[model samples]
Target: MSDLPILIAGGGIGGLATAIGLAQKGVASLVLEKASRLGEIGAGIQLGPNAFHAFDTLGVGDAARAMAVYIDSLRLMDALSGEEITRIPLDEGFRTRFGNPYAVVHRGDLHGVFLKACEAHPLVSLRTASEVLDYDQDGETVTATLASGERLRGRGLIGADGLWSNIRKRVVGDGAPRVSGHTTYRSVIPVEDMPEDLRWNAATLWAGPKCHIVHYPLSGWKLFNLVVTYHNDAPEPVAGMPVTHDEVRQGFEHVSPVARQVIERGQDWKLWVLCDRDPVMDWTDGRVALLGDAAHPMLQYFAQGACMAMEDAVCLSAELAGAGDDLEPALRRYAARRRLRTARVQLQSREIGQHIYHPAGAHAALRNAIMQAKSPEDWYDAVDWLYGSTGLEGAVSREARTLGPE
Candidate 1:
């Protein structure tokens, strides 16, 4: 590898994970974050066994596992009936089969694990408030322009700037992202404040018509993360907007009484309008490439958005590890390896949002019936391609078999 570090835009989970992955391979990278400090702002995220595998590969598995809440199963309940349609066992047998445990964790806790590792690694350089503005690359190197008008040169650039990436418009020439027409309200509260009967430890989803709610214990069961999503035409996409509890209650007024009770318990809710781009074949241009949400943004239904981004970090680092003088070829190889798999995830996430999360009338009934008919093992088999991982190479093969041709 050259002495010059690879320049990474956006210091979110994907960017930090990329730095960690490269440092593990004896490579150097400079991560530029727009924020003044490195921190994650979100409720909760579920990590499958594949995410654990990626974390282990990056040598931070122990720290991540220590902060996570291992759940026994994933239960999908009908909002109207308050009955579990079916549950996927993520118990000892499942862990033994997948080689890792399923965990639900606060997003900040997970980001903190990667951020600490990146800060400690000798090969990683992290800079905050140095937002990437644009880039120009020659045959030898890429120069990234920062918001402060400072120019930094590096061997290559990785655009992990996230959903509304500035680099994507310049690289792939893709226009604005497509809005999902779904608005999300999320809140986290102390577990002690929650009702005794509602203090469930497992990852649970309450599915209803045109709306759904997901809640689970986080911070080692000290806090609970609650997210409620419904169909509403948000004219524009925004995040961290304050929403009144009454507003959220109105959205779920028609839902089951149990779901209503949960919604009523939450205070100080924050809102986000979901947006994602359609996957593209071109994520690389010369020595510049896109990673994570910049490369393939998807809906949150699959719970694989962050997981896939972390996987991309691992795959990209592996490709660039021993490529020596040729960095472009390594980038091309990374893009080729990820394009189809991410496209499948992107499409499947949309399908899940439309069919499983928010169906109406007859479609809703049929969705419930189909879910109730499947056995726990059958549900596991359906997502075998997602939670199973042997490494980057194994991931490509499994994704190929599961998603078929591009």
Candidate 2:
């Protein structure tokens, strides 16, 4: 089995997590990254219970917890007035019920844990600066061409390359991803710089018409991560360009003063044109499968993009390892199990973005009413299913049998 390694494209969170999961399952694989170094650009993400459980399964949940800030509660407020409408406790009770706390961490820090795991494992090898150009799959082998003119042959190829996946082009025909008609501005600020009185150990969301802002501490309370998204007639910023302060302010002219304060704090920011694809029909073709953003690119609304990818890595690895000699069918069954769950996340992320972030007219009022009607715990219940999943038992029992002799 080692003769034909599993080739993973894109070494972001999903790819590395997949590698780690494969290692834990005794399935060896190689991860190919387009960047020269392994790093992620983004602020903190909320790891709901489901992701937290997967993190524990990957054996990094504790390390991640050490680096993350635990949200004691979640708050929903009037976007324009700053009046707290509802609050949900995310502390001991929340953890006890969900089996994991709502933890937040910078994207890079989380990625670091996964990278360390990969490097320490003797079974996992990583090739950086190796961009996948093309791939071909046969009955027993899959081959990928690198930009440097090198070739890698493996039993299966998994693409975790992210939203603009090159591998997706090979498997699914290219027509650009659908834009959500929303623009997101992200920035990280030192926690100390914010007003002391307002500093709270909570994940807070101020929702307004056509825009919303989420803020929480990251890196053990040293820094705060902030993301603001708004529906706009303004053209989405070009990908990979610096977003100026003026651009951010322009999006939230009519928002609350506190919202403006938060935006102003992030004078320098990066912007992304929020786009998502229809849930992919298939993540595997022969021995080649797609994982994470390559398979599904989610908006930040659910904060499940990384979590889903992490779960995907674990399931893929577990199935492959349990399959023992039958790697091909194992890969197929892995895809079937993961594809449905990820597709739901993909579609659900966009739905949250649409309904929660960019609500219009009466829809905005309904969003506000819902916030007023529910406590933070009520909101927690809404997201319970997502953060509560641990794929180990189900994937092992069902997929293992699916890959067994017919």
Best by lDDT: 1
Please report, as a residue range, the 10-residue window in candidate 1 with the lowest summed lDDT.
390-399
Give candidate 1 regions above 4 Å deviation: 394-398, 404-406
Report the lDDT tens digits of candidate 1 across residue range 250-301: 5687777876788878879999999989889879989999999999999899
**TM-score of model number 2:** 0.92
Model 2 Cα lDDT, one tens digit per residue, 268-318: 688877877887656666677788888877777778888888888777877
- Give the winner by TM-score: 1
Clashing pairs in 2: 49-387, 50-387, 50-388, 87-376, 88-376
lDDT of 2 at 215: 86
Worst 10 residues of 2 by lDDT: 397-406
- Flag regions of model 2 displaced more than 4 Å: 233-237, 375-377, 393-406
Clash pairs for candidate 1: none
